[model samples]
Target chain A: MVVNGAAIEFKKVRKTYGNFVALESFSMNVAAGEFMTLLGPSGSGKTTALNSLAGFTDITSGDILIDGVSIARVPTEKRNIGMVFQNYSLFPHRNVLGNVAFPLEMRGVGRAEIRKRSLKALEIVRLGGLAERMPHELSGGQKQRVAFARAIVFEPRVLLMDEPLGALDLKLREAMQLEIKQYQQQIGCTVIYVTHDQGEALTLSDRLAVMDKGLIRQLGTPQDLYDRPNSRFVAEFIGLNNIIKISGSKHDGAIVDGLGVIRFPSEIQPSQGYLSVRPEHIRRTPTGGHPAIVRQAVFLGDAVRYVVETRNGAELTLAEPRSGENSSLDPGSEIAISFEENRLIHLPE
Target chain B: MKNRPTTLLLLLPAALLVGLLFVLPILGVLSLSVYGDSGFTLGPIRELVGSRVSLVVLERTFWQALTVSVICVVLGYPAAFFMSGLSTKLRAYLVYLILLPFWISILVRTYTWIIILGREGIINRTLAAFGFSPVQILYTDLAVRIAMVQILLPIVVLTCLASMLDIDKGLVKTARSLGATPTQAFVKVFLPLSLSGAATGGIICFILCLGFYVTPALLGGRRSILISNLIDIQVHQSLNWGFAAALATALLIITLACLALFRLLTRGRTEFSSLGVGR
Candidate 1:
């Protein structure tokens, strides 16, 4: 099947519910055939943005364009954007084949073509044999797959998914994530997915926008946001990080009030902010580094995580592979911790 | 398992009430239909079959009930649809409005329709002021149907609204996202899901219509007398208890048959439970 991919653009879109602003001046250009995710906590406007694009919610201002044409005034049906909701909203009265064929039927596709294409769509989702089953008879994963089949049967230009796998179990969720990514690739349709799971966003999206308080905090590739998050929120939200408050600037470093002066990378503009470093970046040394007593050691199967408090009363967490050298570090043991200069990320307050 | 006796004991009061007041009375009526003064006889059954007036009234009763149920569904469905679309606060107020008639007795409501549809009533007086002649609508089948629909409409509307509200709003949104226009989405997705509720409402309305006595007696002419009124005449005017009992049994059987047909039509569908009818 030939899938049409449309370039979607949100040109300063804003949505407000009375005095509450759900989305404020949101703007982004999604490339054709790209799988982009809007990752945020609940009430962060990620779903609102997706709903606005789907024509489910009207924007208070600005415009949403699909394929360079403004669809602000277009009704949801005419928008031709397929959406899979968090709960699979399959019509209970219709069987699997009828549900899958609904979009084609609505678009005036002939009866034979609807049947043939619906079966083909079900085949794509590996649900061909269950065509006669009602939605209530299908398992959760099968229902989700049927929802996917229904969404893509018409080969819409854009597919919007709003936490479609949120209701599934962990194993099914993981498998479906891979399946969705593969389907997006095979169909070559532009996908705008909404989710709060950072791991899911990182694994499934070509690029993602991290949203907070109705604004985009950062928009970049998953690794870009993970490695070089522009804000403390992004840094903490993307992955586990130890953030040390920068009290002041010194001659060649920044002063962390209790941890002494920490050297800053030359590229970092010195200011009152925070120094963020991944837990794995902190290395345990035998001596000649910051002297710290291990407060707690947690065995995580693959790695040993040690929470240490420095002599200056600053606490830091470090992780190390469960090897013979560092696996037995117990609480209250005096250890030294150090970090590479390049691994220290400077995030503005 | 030990609590089964306690459950049965707790159910004793309701069981006794149904047995004494309902089951025994129905059994008496059934026996009265077949038994004469001496012993078992089919005299009442033969009279029910032989009487043209009884047959005409029964046919009229069936058609009247069917028409009234159809009218109730037609009027109630749109009102229920509109009510379901309202916000909770607004919907609560609308439900109160729909149920406002329930506070008044059915006889009082039928009487109010009489005052409105009478020759010199409010509507006819208004028509006279507009220089239009009175249309003789008071003692006609139209008057009884109007009165019946007015009294029974709230039940149908509430039932339909409950079913429509039970439906997931997201299904309609899904339909729209699947490229169905608003009308198509309503016609294809919403209509089918809520039909069970409408059917429940219509069935209730039809059953209620079948037993209608006061409205037809007061508003209907001789030609519009329904089965219930005819049974009333047989018992009171003719002093024929057996034939009246026979007519009552026939009406009961027809009502059960209608209910059975409805159950068959909605078999295996769980959405009908949302109607809060038929368990």
Candidate 2:
């Protein structure tokens, strides 16, 4: 539809239901046409933020500006936004074409124009052939497609999705994810997506905010969060990683982490915190590092993951690619591992 | 479900009860109209068609039943809508409140209406105290209609409330997000979805009104008498059991027709009106 999306700004918004604070100083600025996902576990402030923007939930304080206009007093209908609910929520009384045409009809569009736009929107979702079918006749995936068509039929400037693919099966969910990205790109509408799935957030978002307990834990691109997570929670949430607590750090490269004093990489140092390293970064060496024993070996098709325990009783995982001429390790096999010191990130407790 | 013998066994008690209490009597009544001691004849049907009083009373009864059903829908739909918005606990309590009248005997409820609308009753007595003279509402068409409505309102309300509760609230929220005003959402989405329930309830109310005898017998004036009252007179005063059986057969046939229509209206609507079990 080539919509010129609006820039959205949430200025220190807060929402509370009696004693439960849903959002506290939740602020974000989304550029037009950007896909920003709010990623979190359930009960985080992400959904509250989206609901407030759509006027579904009132912000206790602070203001929300779309493009530059304050919409605090604006009703949900007047907000001029479209939302795709988690459940399809297609009107059972209407056919697919009718469902897609509803928004335009509400705006009092001409019949011919409404039909033209609705068909075009349905075509975008690959559901043009099922226009005459009732909602229950369509399968779950088709219903989701029709819901998408209905949301974007009017070509709203901004769209909100609340775990829209939560109901789909694994294969269908993966397929729909790619389709949703393509649709968003074609429409060029700013999408504020909410999901608890980290993989979905990584695949679709231009930027994402990870929230926990009514606050944003971290906000950045997928690469930034994956490569250098700023907290232990984010490190664990974003990807599989090994975190070793740094009990002490010396003026040189020597760091004590309860195991023994190991000479860490000096160039990126000068702190006492946890050592965050990805499994792929720690590799088995021919000799002299830390001696460990493999506890479990799991076959992951592309790589073999081994759970290894150090001499000090710390369990750490490491993965080795199957592409190379590498032999799989058995449980109780003795091995020595070394970290890629330069890739290790320091996180404050 | 496919076990035929078990299915018949499960239905045995109900089948026996209906056969003894309902079917045999209905067959006898219907036979009385067509088969007399002399020979099988259409004499009772002919007399029913020729009698002007019987025809007028039948037409009046039909109109009164239709009016009562329509009034029940109009009054009950809004009350149901209000109930559906309440909290779960509060809604449960209010449903009991509305059903309170259903616990009382229909005869008692009809008589209670007399106390409210009769001369020297509460309404007329209050009017007199306010310096207006007593009005003749005691044994009028209005009094009968009021009593019938009060007696049947509970069924309509429960049916409407049931369908309203089935509706997914997400549809309304989705409508609002798609730029529909609240009133437009309710009119275009909620109203159409809920109409099936109201239609079924109206048909149920209409069927009940068709055979209504007690309220009209007690509250209606001579001019406002319905088909049931006429049938009563034919059996008791005129001692014409054949004509009364014919009138009753007509009422039973019409009620059956309405029940068929109600089934037709409620069955196919599930295809569209029932929002599919959400994804």
Candidate 3:
């Protein structure tokens, strides 16, 4: 009912692109200075939510409040929110200085002050020497930095990024991710970043809302979603997991199921009657528990992913460390399966 | 390195055509403008500068062409922007509407203008039916300007619209998100980005206006005679090839100079290469 430091609130926001609904009664609270990511696949209303906050698109119904003020009728310019597009929309005609000075100019800052502020922002993004260079002259990474400098020069209320790093190569993308995160922290600017890359969302966001089919499947910290996913979709989407469809209920310590009674000491009861376990938590046993056959084993650098066949005829994935010669398991080799009961998570069916 | 021969071969046909038609004729004209007269003298060249009639007609021609070019650019930019903002299907339909007049013969278009601006044309008839005396609208400077602008408007609009389409909409959206009003965004970003195309269009319109004869002759009485009309008068009525050649050479030289100035203005800022105006 209560959230801390949440300056922006979306109260049942809905957006419809003609007959098809883009976002349906979506609601979330973005805390001030908290890096929140709207994590979802395409058509999942993640962008719709970010656009509503950015005022690029209108909401069919409901109110979006920023700092407790309703910004529903506010124009995009008046919203004073910086946005970095996927393509890094730098003004091609203007030099780097002009691009960064644009927002300050729009605010009616004096010529000298705009220059000072623009230079400062450029310096903040570590692009001081490239102030006079045109956008086309800069590399992709430098262009994004110019975009970032232009964005934060005016000190907007909230920074919304719609897959800003989607255009960069993997190596550059990871580097920019860290740089932008540090920049956000240094400025203490509240940011709402939208990305489909689960790794990006997990690495950058303080909290994230995983969306599916225009609905928020779950909202929590990265570890919370990964370790204790509230829904089956969240567990499957967040990270690699061995999600077994076990009919179970909360018992003394964990959910009791027909195949195996995985125990947990958690005091809360899971209502949906399911248990989830991370792939690393489940291990192989030698002939005591349920009999499973190794279907496939992939040797990663330090990790091996195994596709094992359980006795009840369900396939489950198990991950183990590559420690010795026995690390690689042969397919069709009979083995037993057991899970770390203490690390099991019980979710609603 | 290997791309050079292929590129040159690809351009061979156009290069040959330019050499045969444009370069050769221009060279012949230059030689004739001097040599066709007595002893390759500068007498005609000197007379061109000293003659009050030639100077007056040349000045009027340049001013009229400049005015028409300005009007075309001013009117065409907004029209092009509106066209570019349209949906693909609607834009295609609108482009067809613009090119409809272009496909019609320029002589026909000039005559159509004559029908509209003549003493007993639709406008005068309508005014007469309203019990007002018919105004003398035809054979005036205004008629010539209107006709020239109407004939050349499509070029300006298409040129500007092409460039406007090439502009990334994301830049405008980014400007708006940075707290710029739509007007500011257009003026600061879109306007500057589209300048070279607009300039190219303006220069083309100016050059085309320089050699305008049909519209001015059909629409104007005497004072509105441009250099092209004067050249026609010298050749047909006066039968003076030397003076006509001199005027044609002047028009060519002035047009090229204006184009050079335009290129200088747009150099390193915005390239109008897509407009194909360089050739």
lDDT string for model 3 (B113-224, tens) is: 7788888899999998999998887898889999889989999999999999999987888889999999998888899889878988998899888888788888888887
Q: Is the docking of candidate 1 incorrect, acceptable, medium or high quality?
A: acceptable
lDDT score of model 2?
A: 0.89
lDDT of 1 by residue, A1-349 (tens): 6686899999999999999999999999999999999999999999999999999999999999998999999999999898999899988988888889889988888777788898899999999899888889999999999999999999998999999999999999999999999999999999999999998999999999999989999999998999899999999899789998988887778888567888877754465889999999999888778899999989898898889999999888898888665456778898888888788888887
Best by DockQ: 2
Rank ordering of all candidates by lDDT, starting from the highest:
1, 2, 3
C-alpha lDDT of all candidate models, in order = 0.91, 0.89, 0.84
Give per-candidate clash totals.
0, 0, 2
lDDT by residue for model 2 (B133-177), tens: 889997888898999899899999999999999999889888999
Q: Provide interface RMSD per model, one decimal.
A: 7.2, 6.0, 7.6
Q: How are the candidates ranked when ordered by DockQ, highest leading? A: 2, 1, 3
lDDT tens digits, residue span A93-126, model 2: 8888889988988898887888888889999999
Q: Candidate 2 chain B: worst 10 consecutive residues by lDDT?
A: B270-279
Residue pairs in candidate 2 whose N, alpha carbon or C atoms collide under 3 angstroms: none
Predicted structure 1, TM vs. truth:
0.96
Query: Over the stretch A1-349, how does candidate 3's per-residue lDDT look in tens digits?
Result: 0122338999999899889888888988888989999999999999889888888888999999998999999999999898888898988777788888888888888877787888889889989998777778999999999989888888875889999999999999999999999988888878999999999999999999999878899999998888889888888888887666555455644434435545564776443456677879888776567678899989888899889877666777889887867658689888887888678876664
Query: Candidate 1, residues B1-279: lDDT per residue as tens digits?
Result: 657988779889999999999999999999999998989999999999999988888898999999999999999999999999999999999999988989999889888988999988999999999999988888899999999999999999999999999999999999999999999999888998999899999999999999999999899989889998888898899999999999999999989998999999889764332121112
